[model samples]
Target: MARPVISCERHSLRGLLAVALALLLVCAVSAGVSAGQAGAQGLTPQQLAGQRVIYSYRGLTPPQSLLDDIRAGRAAGVIFFGENISSPEQIAGVVAQLRQAQAESPISRPLLLMTDQEGGLVRRLPGAPVPSAKQVGQSPDPVAAAFDAGLGAGRNLRGVGMNVNLAPVLDVFDTPGNFIDRTQRSFSDNPFAVAALGSAFITAQQGTGVAATAKHFPGLGTAPAGQNTDTGPVTLPADLSRLRSVDELPYPAAVFVGVKLVMLSWAIYPALDADRPAGLSPMIVDRELRGRNGFRGVTITDALEAESLNAFGTTGQRAVAAAAAGMDLILCSARDTGQGESATTALADAYAGGQLDPAAFDQAVARVDALRAGLR
Candidate 1:
């Protein structure tokens, strides 16, 4: 079923209807009430929590345990790595199997099958978006290059039955040979240029019906040489001025273009919040990214099992922490279904014991529901 589009125009119904409805959608989606809350009304705490967990697995075929979880509506979705996929044909078959499992689910929406299909070396699949973000940004016409890359990426992902692309890295790097720049993950050092290309890419990619995720926000560009959150603890003591002016400048443009999701950086920025990583900081998630930039879409965490989170405790504990921080999707990317299972159990426990607010949890689930419904 399509989401109802009602006009929010108070005075001039004819001239202002489209703009008002679009604004209303972005606002409602951000607030997490309008999309599909009815679907989450009676869900058990376990199921409600389960709807927030994104799972991963090792090797080609998915484990029976993951399949069983999906069939029981105890899984939100799955993320794919190159290891989980051998070829387009094999992955397509696997997606068909997962889809069948989802069809048996009570959620009545498509499972979010996602992958890191960022252009160039970052892609898991062997196809378009063949150029890196650096290449696109440096091209004669960066905007056009970005659009093509995004269009190709969306088509490629959709063709394989995947609905989400964890891509279009919007991190604007400051120094050359830095983490993001060295990896060719950044488009440009100029925030506005990055914003233009990022917005173009988002527009084209999502235009192909595959959701595009603008990642590592409120920016990972501050990480200097040899710093990587995936490996270990990385703290960026960037000044607040630079963080907002250079690193975070692209975000408002991304939000304006209607990016479906924004993945938070795991790196701790003391300027934003002294204690927790950005992904686990409501100050960043709730204040900077959503409140300041006006991003109404779902917010996702980078990874639950990152080595940087070692001090944060077990997989389940990390899951609770991220959720309490307002991360809608618990990304268990350890290639272990058991990891996600732990997260779901912990989330349910959190919800049950009042560690997580009921209204907030429902809103999270409803936002997730809206995203899933739109995917179908």
Candidate 2:
């Protein structure tokens, strides 16, 4: 069955979502203070656009250009990699530097300092969440292990001045040696088990003030053993029923537990919308995620530099498309300052050029602000 087209801003559940978003603004955690209210007023078009982007850089120290972007209100936050950390103290100092820069800008809220701290080999930082999700599931006490991993990850990230951990993967793979299972990423093949573990992780992690992201939705369990979305495109052809019953099963549990962010996948889902990736599809993002499941928190893209998006044109074009499709934050993790600038500029152009709806854009930026409001 084909999905009927609907405006991203015209969902029938607007009344309920407004209340949900307001609650999101009230749940500040981890560090700093909630200086940001849920509004995008007094911002220039470019600054408004900048509030929707998360930038990244290479090496140990972030470039002055990146700091300048923050100071100028042209950046919302940044994602970190292992290459950017030498020690906990070093990255903590780097976070302090960025925070000071952010203080000078119009936006006074804490910058979303984040990393892929999913545990085991996937963590960017050096410690905590030592056990993989797969191992946790295979343990005698899976629920306890999940909570421990989440608590460990949250404390680890918060101690280093970081606020978000892109972790607790909820992908429910079907077979052994599959992509998620092979990397020890997914908790279990059972959707109910994934839901319980993921909820436990979220509850424990967010209690420590550092927010956790439930990623690669609507689930990447079907991704092949060797096919990576980072290098190229991969389409999962699961039917709508299976996608809802299995892939999307854990999301409701996560949302109920108040997960701060959700990272959508670049992989295309023919059952949802075959024309574009889940992150760039209105049916998948606005309809399936928001309208159907009521996930009103921040929606982040997987990574803007993925080779899977070559067909979508350049960074600016892609950013505009994602934003128009109801995504709130664009993750540009190429480790190049220029890549981020390009995306920021393109979004500013789109907003200024009337390519994006004013009401919806403001609402989207406010949603990002709402997430930032929950952070220190």
lDDT (0 to 1) per candidate: 0.84, 0.83
The residue-by-residue lDDT of candidate 1 on 1-376, one tens digit each, is 1222333322232323343234334432222224456387677888889999999999999999999999988998999999998899999999999999999988788999999998878999999989999998777656667778888899999999999999889998776676787779998777777776787777778878898899989888878788789999989868999999988988887777678999999999998898999999999999998788888888898989999989999999999999989899989999999999999999999999999998888888888888898885
Candidate 2: Cα lDDT at 206: 84
How do the predictions measure up, each by TM-score? Answer: 0.91, 0.90
Candidate 2 has a TM-score of 0.90
* Tens-digit lDDT string for candidate 2 (91-122): 99999999999999988777999999888779
Q: List the residue pairs that clash in candidate 2.
A: 30-209, 31-376
Model 2 worst lDDT window (10 residues) = 1-10
